[model samples]
Target: MESKIKHLEMVENIIERMAKNCFTLKGWGITLIAGIFALSAKSTEQKYVLVAYIPILVFWFLDSYYLQIERKYKILYKNISAKSESEIDFDMDTNNIIITESVAKKLCYFRCLFSVTEWLFYCPTLVAITILIRILNVF
Candidate 1:
């Protein structure tokens, strides 16, 4: 009983840490974009958009990876917590969860990039980039 609670706590801590990493990646992405805009605003070069997008895309992919990991841990957490007392064990390994080869291949990080939660953060920035590009063309 107590051991089950402890295992659950460990799972939760891992989830919380991964969640923090996802948020941190997002914050850095936003900051990098803002820095690019500020630099672009000061210069006549139209290449800054390219410069800006590279990092944004990289960070977006990395952030999605963390989000996917967090989600997996949450699933593990649920499995741990939902177990009956008699069925509970200290096994916290999520890798043991069987994933079919097809399902595993389909759940790539690229797919996660388009997930609704990720879009909520990145879509606005994409729109802003387009606006900036159009504005550059005008001048």
Candidate 2:
């Protein structure tokens, strides 16, 4: 029983770390975008606005990757909770869990890319950049 508790604690810690990573990525994404915007404004160069797309897309993908893993770990936590103490082997890998739900299918890379949280943070930023590019006559 104690070992099971320890195993759960470990998994929870991983989930927390993944969440922090996603948060950090979002922060960095915004920071990079802001920096790019500053550069564009200072130089009056429209190219920097377009360049902002690279970090936004990269961070979006990276955030989705972390979110997917965090979700898998959440599923792992549920699976672990249902097991008998003796069944707990302290294995942290989430790959063995057979994904069954339609929602769980969103855990895949491409699907996660459009996940609500991902879209909420990134899409607006992209739109803002696009609008800025248009205003700058970058086309």
Candidate 3:
């Protein structure tokens, strides 16, 4: 029972650490993207919109990913927490509650989602801008 408690506490710590890392990554990514778009844009209307959209998309995807991770962690935590309270002796050696392989797989999928969505907005906007410049140059 004591072992189960310790194990759950450790899992909670790991989840918290992961959440922090995600937050930092999201912050830097949003800031850099917004800054680049703003610096390159000719006007506030263009720059502000693009800058605003970048963070929104980033946060939306990050939130989705975090929520998925949170749900899984919650489920695992609940199970382990309940076990700790039960009459049955939980052998920590055998019942260590590690984040399952499936959780890692889901996390990987979320990462891929972030990558694709981020590029979807950034790459297309860049290409469009390049085409516009070329057209203007021809005139």
- Could you say which candidate leads in TM-score? 2
Full-model lDDT for every candidate: 0.78, 0.88, 0.56
Quote the positional error of residue 7 for candidate 3 in Å.
1.2
lDDT of 3: 0.56
Deviating ranges (above 4 Å) for candidate 1? 84-89, 98-111
- Considering TM-score, which of the candidate structures 1 and 3 is the better prediction for this target? 1
lDDT of 1 at 47: 72
Where does candidate 3 have its weakest 10-residue lDDT segment? 87-96
Better of 1 and 2 by lDDT: 2
In model 3, the Cα lDDT at residue 34 comes to 57
TM-score of 3: 0.46
Candidate 3 structure quality by residue, lDDT tens digits, 1-119:
67777768876876786567566655665577556555646554443434445554565566556645655565566667766355434333313445667755654645545555444
Per-residue lDDT tens digits of candidate 1, residues 90-132? 7767686445576555456676778887888888877777788
Model 2 TM: 0.92
